[model samples]
Target: MAIKGSGSPMEAVDEYFDMLIKSRFIEMFGDIKTNSKGWKCHKLGELGSFKTGGTPSSKHEEYYQGTIPFISTPALGPNYIDDSAAKYHISKEAIENCATTLIPAGSLIIGTRINVGQSSINKIPMCTNQDIVSMMDIDKKYDLLFLKHCLNQYIPYLDSQKKGATIKGITVELLKSVMIPEPPIDEQKQYVDFVEQVDKSKAVCK
Candidate 1:
């Protein structure tokens, strides 16, 4: 069915839910860039250990023959993803010999290059290309989903920080220096729960 204005029915539904989520997010966190809620702020790097990803040499055909998912900046999605999200696979031998390292499941993968601020949570252990960085061993005081939403709000700021003569990208130092407001753990959980409900509603729209 056609909507009253522009866009198809699906597009209108998606935009409606997008606005709902954004409005609720702003109501809960205020302006994240200015810490408008008067919450204590912490540098993002302080919350976790970060590992820069690396690509294995492609000359070795054997490297691609294994089952481990190899993610890259292009595969860093808007939400949680699993091994199937990636198009490439790497072998165990590739890890032993290549610069790529295995990041644990549930770690957040961020696109430092190309897309600049795109990110996702990996639901399975995987390796990534040089353009991505994985945030692992996060502090327990914060919920993972809470941190993800905070980072999502920083996309515009992060995009502005990208620098390069060719392939523009954000540096680990820049990511580390970026600060985010930290609400109480219970409050963070509540927001995450709210987001989850919104996501379910979005899925129904899809």
Candidate 2:
């Protein structure tokens, strides 16, 4: 259907819904100041890849005792994540068998099930359980720190998309299909730099 100017009643209805979707996005992620049309919008999957992890064989006693960090929903913190926070460690044998993907240091993770909307960046390399989704190999064109804050702003939208009457949860497909606004890299860097300075002043490390 032609979007510029709807001619028939049905065409008008389609146009109306299109505008409604964009308008909601504007409301959720404030209108871009410099951009005339608005920020560039991209599906989460287009920007990067998504991976959901799996548990190794629980029956194998050796899989439970190893060096590789096994991340879980309980270990997730708002801003930071320590792999050590994970209760279980997977062995090399488990990694060869059950590992679907490896989440690199500084990559973002969010729980898909019970702890919906909570997110954190891992400080060390690790693998997560099936209940969570992790974004790895994020496109360098976008600032990671900036993307983190944008996701922070986007938590509410994610919550609203949750399905299931008894248990609220999101699927990997749901997360991958979500659309996000992308400000220019330069604009993103400004926000990242500002936050770093703020954290420094607060002595965030201590």
TM-score of each: 0.93, 0.73
lDDT of 1 by residue, 1-206 (tens): 33356487777777676567667878988988898888899999999999988888889999999999999887775678897788899999999987789999989888899977788999999999889889999999988988888888888999998899999999988887878788898988988888788879878868
lDDT of 2 by residue, 1-206 (tens): 34666787665654555354435435544743323456677777887777888889888999888888898887764456786577888877887888546788878888887777667888888888888889878987787766666565556777887888887788877777656677677766766666555545434323
In order, how many clashes per candidate? 0, 0
Name every residue pair that clashes in candidate 1.
Answer: none
Candidate 1, residue 40: lDDT? 90
Candidate 1 lDDT for residue 142: 87
Whole-model Cα lDDT per candidate? 0.85, 0.71
State how far residue 143 of model 1 sits from its true place (Å).
Answer: 0.6
